[model samples]
Target: MKQICVFILVLALTSCEYFNAKKTTPEAILNEELQTFNWNDVDVYPTFSECDSIETKNGKTTCFTEVLTTHILEKLQKDSIVVTQDVTDTINLKFQVSETGILSLLNIDTDSLIMKEIPNIEALIYSSLDSLPKVFPAIKRGQQVKTEFELPVIIQAN
Candidate 1:
């Protein structure tokens, strides 16, 4: 019994160094991971209910783009826009999707000529997106995160 006790004490003393080693905090690990991570890409793209069924990233992205473009076009058509002069412009629409799936416009880059032709283009785009269906926020690292996306909308008039 005495020999056994002495052996156990020696083992415990040697193992003390293992317990005293520095421990990393959760914040430190997260900061390091975030530093090395690519923020431009997401594990899963934001999805509309109609797009949730799609499994591939590109599929979901295509669906989302189609739905968004269709909605915007529909809104523009509903306005019965009639341009006096031929206008062709590609508007870069920048928007952010919240972690909770809400979408909001950040900026709209349109040619002055297009804006002059369709004065209410901004409002139309805003209303169309405001009425969009519920969205599922983008996923990053298994957590829902806000994401910004830019879509180019082409406007042409004869």
Candidate 2:
């Protein structure tokens, strides 16, 4: 009886969390996962309806960029911008797509010469986005998330 009692006590003590076991709760596990999650990366990049047909990841990004560039180029082409001294520059546009699929421009970086040549360039770019194809928010861990992008657009005029 003494030996059985000692054995049982040892088993119980070792099994208790104070000795060895640390029970993992759902909340704890979730918190741990959140801490390790990469917020900057997404499983699926944000895209437009026009790019929905693309099956590959790279294809989707390319299509998204092409569609956006085409829209902006079309808008700029209509303005008949005239520049002297063969102006050539690149506009680095930074923007965000909200989790709700709404787009907002954060900033536009361009040469001062380009700004002077195309006085309404910023407004034109903003306005062009107004009519872009429907946007879908990026997907991360099966949840829609906001994403930011920096796209470069070249400006050239003779």
Best model per TM-score: 2
lDDT of each: 0.89, 0.88
Q: Which residue ranges in model 1 land beyond 4 Å of their true spot?
A: 1-28
Q: Candidate 2 — which pairs collide?
A: none
Poorest stretch of ten by lDDT in candidate 2: 13-22
lDDT of 2 by residue, 1-158 (tens): 99999999999987886677568999999999999988878888889898888898889889888888888888888877767668788999998999999988999998999888888899989988888878899999899998999999988788
Give the distance in Å from residue 7's predicted Cα in candidate 2 to where it truly belongs: 7.9
Question: Could you tell me the C-alpha RMSD of candidate 1 in Å?
Answer: 4.3
For candidate 1, the 10 contiguous residues with the lowest summed lDDT are 72-81
lDDT of 1 by residue, 10-85 (tens): 9999989888969899999999998999989999998889997898999999999888888887877777778899
Give model 1's TM-score versus the native structure. Answer: 0.80
Question: Each candidate: RMSD to true structure?
Answer: 4.3, 2.9
- Which residue segments of model 2 deviate by more than 4 Å? 1-21, 25-27
TM-score for all models, in order of appearance? 0.80, 0.83
